[model samples]
Target: MQSHNQARANAARRRQAETGESYAAALAAIRQDRLNEADHATEAGNPPVDRGPDYFHDKPVPEVLTELVRYHSHRIAKHLYFAMDEGRWRSDFAEWQAMTLYKLTDAAAHLNLLIGTITAYLRDEGVGRYFLRRYLQVNQDHQVEAYLTPRVEEHLAGLTGQPAPEHSIIWHSVGSDIASQSGWNHPEQHEALEAALHALYGNYPDDDEAFNHLPPALRERVLALIPLMKDQEHSGAAD
Candidate 1:
């Protein structure tokens, strides 16, 4: 910014000498030229960038950074509570699918995009250097993140969750995760079983409730698995 101011002042002096204008008038003219340039750049879809200070310009950088971290922490905690709470829970495949259930929401995609954009931006800006050498990853507790749990594999293995052991808690399993979990042995069968679990289970704690929830014809279709599996894991067929 200092270099830019110096360059602008030099231009104003030259303009004043050439146009026989007062120093103040010359400076005003130079400023107007820059405004016009910025307008043109915006029209061209190449908006100009001269990052010096943001709107909270009076605050020191450390103070600004501190406030950002504090408030964003509150924002993130609220987000997690809202997402993970029983009544508002979400994941990869809320919509029905042949594969058990991938997720109940698209939040993972949103979080990944956030991580990609912010990390790239911080590194591009010189500020990212502060932690680069000292930290193994930027996606540490310092930033938002997304990941999968073993439960996803559980779901894929045709392990329907058991009824809530208590009102607030549900123990999820079908058979031994190792026994039921298998490689893609029978593609068509696996696909059938995977889909059937989510569709049949359908948030019902009991198998009968899930079966009753669906029309008889479609009820069994939900369990179709690709990399196939079944809890108690038998459909009178070979794996």
Candidate 2:
């Protein structure tokens, strides 16, 4: 009986690993597409709104990064807890696939347009270097970042001719693998997530200098987000 039980446990573990892998692959693909869309949107001249630093002008950079890390950590923890619950918490595989697929689609659409505009402005103002630097600094702390941070950093670092340490790369890759196994539903958690992201974007190196580097349309988008970022700051504080 003991041997039989051990075999069953092993089988269950295998299944969980497989499920997590499938989920992670799907998520990574979705994020990639979203990033691409942002670039495409900017190139097409259909720029989205950019909320200026009012979004996060008053906030500190390290605080923003910390918030982002906490938000994701909380999200991942909740999802993992639910996914591992074999009782009332057990979710159907179909549900997991469907939900993540839709989330990816939406996230990609939003990012494509936003990132496109943001990058265009960065290119114009010659602030891509600032962005690259800030991103690198925040991502070097792999102990806390999500799976996406290092991956994005790796690609961005390559663009800047900076080599990412092998250990950091491995750590993020493993984190991503672990994240793929989670599947918790919590839109309520987005408040904190958005706040952190807004803070990071708001605290760009130099507002005037960076703005000058961006294209007109891209500038408009950045300008638009400033308010939103500020709102998020207020919201985060209130919470």
Q: Which prediction has the highest TM-score against the true structure?
A: 1
lDDT of each: 0.40, 0.43
Residue 86, model 2: Cα distance from true site in angstroms:
14
Top candidate when judged by lDDT against the true structure: 2
- RMSD in order of candidates: 25.3, 24.0
Per model, how many backbone clashes are there? 29, 24
Please provide, for model 2 over 1-239, each residue's C-alpha lDDT reduced to its tens digit, 9 standing for 90 to 100.
23322343344445557676443353444446656975675567642244332233344643323333443455554454444453345467777666555555554533332233233333433443444335334444332233234344543333333465465544233223223322332334644444344335442432233344445655566666777767988999999
Taking all chains together, the TM-score of candidate 2 against the true structure is 0.21
TM-score for each prediction?
Answer: 0.23, 0.21
Question: Candidate 1's residue-wise lDDT over 1-239, tens digit each?
Answer: 23454576778789989999987677778879998986675567632243222222344444322222232233343444455553344344443241222232344433443233233333434433334322325445344222222332232222222332223221123212212343312334434444554554343222223344444545556534312444435664545
Error of 2 at 149 (Å): 23
How many backbone clashes are present in model 2?
24
